[model samples]
Target chain A: MSDSRVSSVIQEWAYSSQAHTQTLNPTTTNHAGSTSQLTQMDMIPYSQSQGLVRGGTDDRVTEQMMGLSYLPYTSSSCLSNSSSTGTTNHHQGHPNTQQDFSSFLLPSLRAPVNKRSISKDSAEYRLRRERNNIAVRKSRDKARRRILLTQQRAQHLQEENQKLQMRIGQLTQELDTLKHILSQRHLHGAEEGVAGESNI
Target chain B: MSDSRVSSVIQEWAYSSQAHTQTLNPTTTNHAGSTSQLTQMDMIPYSQSQGLVRGGTDDRVTEQMMGLSYLPYTSSSCLSNSSSTGTTNHHQGHPNTQQDFSSFLLPSLRAPVNKRSISKDSAEYRLRRERNNIAVRKSRDKARRRILLTQQRAQHLQEENQKLQMRIGQLTQELDTLKHILSQRHLHGAEEGVAGESNI
Candidate 1:
């Protein structure tokens, strides 16, 4: 791929991360709680205003890649339901919201468009869409889980590290105390002089 | 936002994750270690063959988002030089090769296509491309660092955890020995029994 083109796409990613009234649906909880087509429809105009028609068949592919075209984002977004107002709630629910739009959506690849205007209504395209729908959900669920797991592992490790450091500290202190007592008695050899330390 | 459309994009993501001869550029080292428009052109036919013309001005945006548009991929792909044959090298160097093209490139959201036929040669598009190129590189570098840091932290924690466990074992053993000696003495005192169990 041309570096120039990648930059253009990333630029759109950067653009998408911003809270543009013309660009975003701006729902974290709303989208997740929303099981209706109405919620999807509500978000369409905003996505369409950005340039790609959310309703358009070709662009719908792009929408999925964005991770924004669909409703009911699980876990982080869906779990938290706050505010009737929009943009603020987006940040409130998901920490990786920018990553979802920018990093996650980074690849907005269009399969070499030899057939750019391929009939979206075609049976093959519909089949691809259905398969993709399943795949994306599975893929996203997997993605979300992996990220959460990584974060949890990191947290667990940090706590373990601190506990280890504390243990090391305790061991060193014990060794020092043993040395001090032996030194006061002018004793040599740890095995004999500090046979059991404080263990009787 | 339609589940069907999102699935379609993710299905492409799955497809992209695979080693499709026609669909992929199949370069990890080749793209990064070398630098030239010629190399970019060389990969064009493969990417072009993916049904989206790599040579097309309009489709270049999608190509960028796919994380496949550019000549040079830094770090994980660039650092290792293992294979001369194409597809093998892609997997050989980058562990997250699929993540790069699939998850990292996941967003692929297009600006709503109001002006679908935006002139590529136009100064505006050119500027956007230039800015995006810088942003993408920076963004990717940040992402790589984050993932690496997380992995490193987990490894470090595991090692620390083992060491802490060992220390706890030692401390417990010393405490047990102290108790045994105290029991042998048959002298039951509150503070004297367990005081400084292993600290001399």
Candidate 2:
């Protein structure tokens, strides 16, 4: 699939998940007005095209919509698991629906959805997703940078530790040498004392 | 002083320096044997006499010991500059003295020898100083634990950079609410959208 097409599907999925969330939870009413505005602004073109597709085969449309609806439920479930497992179960459950969606769209529906939604939801989705993608990328990059810095720091610390260990070895060696020198000096002093004793 | 007395004096200085380092630098060598041995063998006499001086010259002893010998000249420079530049010039001039003699005692020392030798020549000086103090504490800690673990990590990273900021307060508040509901319905969904959203 084309990059643009994949992004559009992801946006639709995001929107479906969001809509399901709004429907399931009423407390999100505070942002309802803005979300509805966004939906109307973003969804009108895609919805219109969807209306055109609706005319062709009612059964397939119903099945696809039903599958789309089920998506939000699964996605919501996936979102819930996101914290602990992170996309594992979501990815597991996603391929079936996503494959169905992709296959169904890949045929006659693909052309219409792509053309119409491209102007509206696709653009908005692309923009928003791009922005979000940038944010996620930035976040990941930042985390990566932190990890890189940390790794560098760890490397530097290990180097310092090695240097310190080397220093300790050197100091120990020097101390041994000094002790040897001191002992030699002590022997010389003892010999001098013996000579003085013999003369006395 | 006799050689035994000189050794004793050096050992006393080591003990005093160790005590001072423990006070100044908390995270240090974990080897308890040497420290405990030092305490039992060396500290008893000093502690007992400290009790005696707890009667007579406590303040004077503290004062004198404080001024005794910051033998790691770099450490003294660091202590001096800690209030100012932290660890600026420390690493630069270190290797010269450190590399030499690893055993040779310095002579005619520069600052009254502090009533004890604190020069680069002092093996005990390097060992005591380097073991206790590292140049990069915050960086090392940050690297060791990763930014995700520390509240201060966020603060420090934020201070270091202003670009990677997120709405932490809003995210945290939303997360708390989500976590509350998630705990309530954890059995029902067995998936976690809330967590995934929060991570994003």
Candidate 3:
């Protein structure tokens, strides 16, 4: 086929890609309307140890791991709501699935080494790029969330540390007062020291 | 080249690949002799917010984000130590970096659609596969580390909760003891109420 024909075919592929996405993501399509249920589950627990991310059945973790805000754009409205992050492209459909691979083809993205660089024009190359992009984003976001959650955890621990210190202070002060009272009574020559007066 | 010559060239490429990796990983090599210092830093904080993972400066996070056990296998002994996770490849200059993509070519990995499968026999195709493999592994290890860290955090929080609960119990018991003693003294017709006796 000539170059013009290939370009025309590419345009056709671009338009129908949305419809094709439904097929590419049957699992996601099945998951479309059930986001509300996933939201409820997210509120309960989202533990990988709990087997929340089983293979094939749903390699996807609980929506909590991905964050409700980052959950797949199961609908057009949800897509718009999550657009600000620009990280939602590969959220199991929602069109433009190839954008990651396409964007990755930045003219400046030569390999880190100096030997002959690889070609960029093959179908396998394109598909590999697409998957790599998806996985990379997924990985990076996972890292970011891990850091954020840890930060939150550190904050909580710090607060708890402060509270525990304060409680110890209060208890120590109260103990000091009680001991002082008991000692003062002894100095005043009461026959009964606090111990002697106490009937156990 | 003839088929036999091609096979010989492939062998040569494999051998020299290790030497070439040093070029691919100048940053990681610079980090090689300084791992002990990085270990000391690990005992402190490992926050992304603190700019611990500045791009290219050190795309790597703290040695903590990756457990010290998993810190790039920077030495030969370290490589053996990390053999169990089978994830030590792509740690800047490890050999056999093509495994992920090579493994990805399993016949079972045909596209999810009915379209003709992509051609996988070009130089660019192989390199892209190689890089994609590295990225996928990097991404996956990151995720595993994330889940593990969260698990550790959860365990620490649970332990703290139990300790706090025990502490509250202890405080309550002490308060009850003090209250009982005061009440008994009052019943014995002490002139001073415990509260009035306690001058702040």
Candidate 4:
């Protein structure tokens, strides 16, 4: 909600658009049925990276708030909460540590933590990831809603069309029946007139 | 573009929405603050595990494709291209050998990879993600245009309102002037009549 966050989100959005334009342009020009994912995966890292950066800043702010609260109030409840969180983090961190170790199985992972630790970038990267994830959710909801609305509109139109067709068919049948009756009456009157003239 | 990818993307989208709704739901007994990345970090291990599975699949596909193209029926140019790609990949594969590892890094490398490695899921996710980004852009643009149009309309309305107020004021002034002139004429006529009567 911070101005900085909004600014960063906007900045990242611009970057994302440029990335999309670049990827789509290549697909159109080469006629290579390039997988949309290929372009997407290629572009996502930047967005993710941006998100991570933003997230880190947000995290820092949270940390600062926690730090400030810790300083002034010295509330026993707050301390207890922090301690409980620390303990919980420790418990959860274990599984993640095991998983992180496994990531090193990749040749890329052979490079020591000092070299490849996205840790420095992790804060911002994490933020961006979270933001992108949120944005992704929003868009998905929007799309689903759009699709649903479109389907509904189509159904309404179809119903209207069917009703119109039925009305036209009914009118046509009525017109035919009226014409037949009129013709028959006209013929019968002609015959009567002819017979009357003969009688005269 | 595969049906599977689409479905999973839909699932991912659904899951994300569920998560967001869960987060936003005020009625729910369960409340989680935006502060804790602890839950997110816990999920990271699962994501990493998923990433490993995906990496294996990608390697398997790449290798299988490489093997398939090994036959003589595959053109020399195609074979050469594959060989070059393989060599390039192999060379690129070594972490220590590369001076510019950043260039070699896939967007996936820096980001979290989900366990569901299907292109279908990713394609759908990417589609959703791109769509979301586009939607954000579109909504923002719409809002901006709306603001500008509203401002223009307001200015016009304000101008119109001012002109009307001025016209009302002018009419009031004219009425007042006409009343004063009529009253003065009446007074003069009354005085003249009185004077004439007195003279008679």
lDDT of 4 at A22: 15
DockQ of each: 0.07, 0.01, 0.03, 0.01
How would you encode candidate 2's per-residue C-alpha lDDT over A1-200 as one tens digit per residue? 12232343343343334221211221222222222322321232323322222333221211112111111111122111121111111111121122224344435333233333333223454355445644654454344334334333333444445455565556556555655655665576567556555654
Candidate 3 per-residue lDDT over residues A1-200, each given as its tens digit: 11232233233223224222322222233233433333333333344433322333333344244333323323222111111111122333234453323223333332223222223333454355545644654454454445445545544564575587678668767866775765564464355334344532
Poorest stretch of ten by lDDT in candidate 1 chain B: B80-89
DockQ leaderboard ranking: 1, 3, 4, 2
The pairs that clash in candidate 2 are: A79-B192, A79-B193, A80-B191, A80-B192, A80-B193, A81-B191, A81-B192, B71-B118
What digit string (tens of lDDT, one per residue) describes model 3 on residues B44-124? 334443332222333334424432322332222111111111112223333434232322434433223322322233345
In the range B1-200, model 4's lDDT, one tens digit per residue, is: 11232233233323323221111111111111221212322222323322222333222111111111111211111101011111110001111221333334455332123335423224554455445644654453343333223333333444445555565556556555655655665576567556655654
Identify the superior model by TM-score, candidate 1 or candidate 3.
Answer: 1
Q: Candidate 3, which segments miss by more than 4 Å at Cα?
A: A1-158, A186-200, B1-125, B183-200
lDDT, candidates in the order shown = 0.38, 0.31, 0.38, 0.30
Backbone clashes in model 3, listed as residue pairs: none
TM-score of 4: 0.26
Better of 3 and 4 by DockQ: 3
TM-score of 3: 0.30
